[model samples]
Target: MIDEQTARERVVSAADRLFYARGVQAVGMDAVRSESGVSLKRIYALFPSKEDLIVAVLRHRTDRWNAGVTDAVDGAGTPRERLLAVFDFLAGWFREDDFRGCAFINVFGELGGGSDRIAEAVREQKESFRRQVADLVRAAGGPGHLAPQLVLLAEGAQTAAAISRDPDMAGHARAAADTLIRCALDDAGEPAAAA
Candidate 1:
């Protein structure tokens, strides 16, 4: 028998898959119950409401997504490569058969204006992505101000890749990022710090 925590995870995982594939409003609680194989009573007991379940799923996805990106960055040879590695990470993600752009972007577009909880979760995810970019920028000795632009590029690439159905979007974004980083280094007049 699955424990409560395991059962909860199953619910969240099923919800995450459904919500990402279909808009939040398009999916129903019964669908989640069916997909998760958790009893309907237990599902409601854990989430209380559909909105609560949505929030839980968003939080769970964000945690897992960030961990994946963080691991990719951590594995890089240098802080700068780590910066580029973000795009590499995205490239891998974009190439996935199930890739439908970013979950944060999709969820936000689906429910941002109507749901305060969802909006807050979306904001947190975007902020965390920027924070990761900012850390890379600082480590690479780039201008402190480039984090926002980097985030924009990263986001734009994801949107474009999803819409255009082109996995090369990541490659294109990586080139742009490299150019931006190089320019920053040239502007800083510091001999491109090793790696």
Candidate 2:
């Protein structure tokens, strides 16, 4: 028999796949059991409720999202490139066959009002993202005001790409980000910093 951790991982993975493809409310415990190949009793033992499973899935997705962004930024050679690498990451993610936009955003929109735990999880992820962008902006020598604008561009790009079914949205957002970075640096009287 699989260990509890392994079983829990399987259940969360299965639930995440189902919840992302279909709405969370649309997927039930039976579907999770079927998708996970774990017994219903075992699944319940691991996650007492669907809400518990949902939180675990959100945590899993957040880890992945954080890792992807960190990897993209780490791969870049300069601070400016690192900032833009976020959009590059998004572009590749958008091209994936199963891309369904941001999971955090999707879940928040689905159950933000009624679920305090889920809402808090979503808020934490978003705040974490804003903090990351702010750090990248500081490293790139951008003014304080530039971070929020860049965050808006990145967030808007994801929503637009998902709804409009256009992966090119990343490219468009990237271009806009480049312009913003350059302009912000120029406004700060450090035009060369963007380079």
Candidate 3:
């Protein structure tokens, strides 16, 4: 028998795949139980309700994604490169076989403007992403507001790529990001540095 930790991890893994592929609302607890190979009782024992499971799943994915972004930026040699890392990461993600829109955005849409705990979670996650991007932009010597704009562009590209099934949409986004960075630096009386 799997240990509690192992069982919980299995359930989370299953939730990640199912929740991302299909909206959280579309996937039932029974599906999570079957996919994780855990009994329904065990699944409920781990997560008291579907909402709790959704929150757990969101937290898991958010942690993983933030870690990836941190690694990507930290590995860069320069601040400009670090800023560009966000785009590079998204570009690669867009090419993935399982690529879908941002999970938070998808969940928000699935909920349809309902004000609930899940919506609040989604909002917090998105704001966190924007803040991270803003910090990177500021570090790159771009204007203070550049991060929000870049994040908007990135989110728009993700939505477009998912809907149009066009992976290359990331290229346009990257170019736009480059221009935005250049403009921001110039506006700040700083010259853009080579990445």
Candidate 4:
């Protein structure tokens, strides 16, 4: 018999794959059980409900997001590059064979209005993303106001990349972000920072 934690991980992993590829509403518990190789009875004992499972999956996605973006930013040599690394990360993600856009956005559109818990999960993830961007902006010597605009560029790029099936979307967003960063620094009267 699998331990509770192990089983829970398996279930969430499988559900995340299915839900992101398909829609959350399109997949059923039976499919999760099948993909996870855990019994349906055991799945329920672990998740209690589909919503519970989705929450777990969102948590998993958040973890992945944090790690991936952190790694990309860490590889950069400057705050400016670090700020742009976000789009670099997105470009890599977009190139993946399983690329399907932002899972949080996907979940939000499909079920945000119906479930408070799910909406909150999505909100938490998005807020975390915004905070990450804001921190990068600060490090790059950009004004506080630039964070939201940079975020919109990144967010819109993700959507456009997914819809257009084009990985270059990240490059486009990065160019726009570069322009914004340049202008923000100029407006702040700060000398042009190294890229």
Question: How accurate locally, in lDDT, is each candidate?
Answer: 0.88, 0.92, 0.84, 0.92
Give each model a TM-score. Answer: 0.96, 0.96, 0.93, 0.97
**Which lDDT value does model 4 have at 166?**
94
Tens-digit lDDT track of model 2 for 47-165: 99899999999989888989999999999998889999999999999999999888888999999898999999998888888999999999877899999999899999999999999
Residue lDDT tens for model 3, 1-195: 899999998999999899899878789988998899999899999999887778787888888888878888888887777877887788888999999888888887887376487888887788889889988877777878888888888889999999998988888988998888877777877754463
Clash total of candidate 4: 0
Poorly placed runs, candidate 1 (over 4 Å): 193-195
For candidate 1, write residues 1-195 as lDDT tens digits. 689999999999999999888878899999999999998999998999998998899899889879988988998987668888889999999999999998888988888899999899989988888998998888777898777777888899999999999999999999998888878866876576563
* lDDT value, residue 64 of candidate 2: 90
TM-score, candidate number 4: 0.97
The alpha-carbon lDDT assigned to residue 50 of candidate 4 equals: 95
What does the lDDT read for residue 51 in candidate 2?
91
Clashes of 1: 0
Each model's backbone clash number: 0, 0, 0, 0
**Model 4 regions more than 4 Å off:** none
Model 1 residue 166 CA deviation (Å) reads 0.7
Residue 180 displacement in candidate 3 (angstroms): 0.7
Q: What is the C-alpha RMSD of each candidate to the true structure, in Å?
A: 1.3, 1.1, 1.6, 1.0
